[model samples]
Target: MAVEYHGFRVTVDAKADATDTQWLCRAVLEGVEAQSETAKLPCIELAIPKLKIDVLMALSMVEQTAKQAIDEWWHARQPEMA
Candidate 1:
């Protein structure tokens, strides 16, 4: 699944681990504006720590975690006020 948030493209995926006991989720974030640029920022990948047995729940957790990561990444790049 994919969605656009704050000028970024967030893509999320989930799969059953090798043990098939839980669902593993990950998210990839890329700059939408930099898609055509050669010097684009490297895509950021986030592995959600929360595991779930249900696919839908896993996806939900991944999405929330990814958005939080995006927010933090954006804030870190901003200049601090004096």
Candidate 2:
């Protein structure tokens, strides 16, 4: 449902509707592709698999954040224009 990042690049994404943590993680990766330069930037960390995954994978996605998810991703990839 959303992407969170540091290191001047996006890192994590959170989702609730996904069937599992891994699925949500993939969705985040896909979202980054659709919404950011993630597709172009091969070095983005979105592909790293989580080792200590949380059992509470289902998250209450913030409607506000979800709505802005695309914009947030775009910003991360193009902060200068944002």
Per-model tally of clashing residue pairs: 0, 0
lDDT of 1 by residue, 1-82 (tens): 9998766777888876677666677777777755322323344433433342467777877787777776776666654721
**How does each model score on TM-score?**
0.69, 0.24
Best of the candidates, lDDT: 1
Regions of candidate 1 where Cα sits further than 4 Å from its true position: 34-53, 79-82
Per-residue lDDT value at 26 in model 2: 29
RMSD (Cα, Å) of model 1: 4.1
Cα-based lDDT at residue 18, candidate 2: 42
Q: What's model 2's overall lDDT?
A: 0.38
RMSD of each: 4.1, 9.8
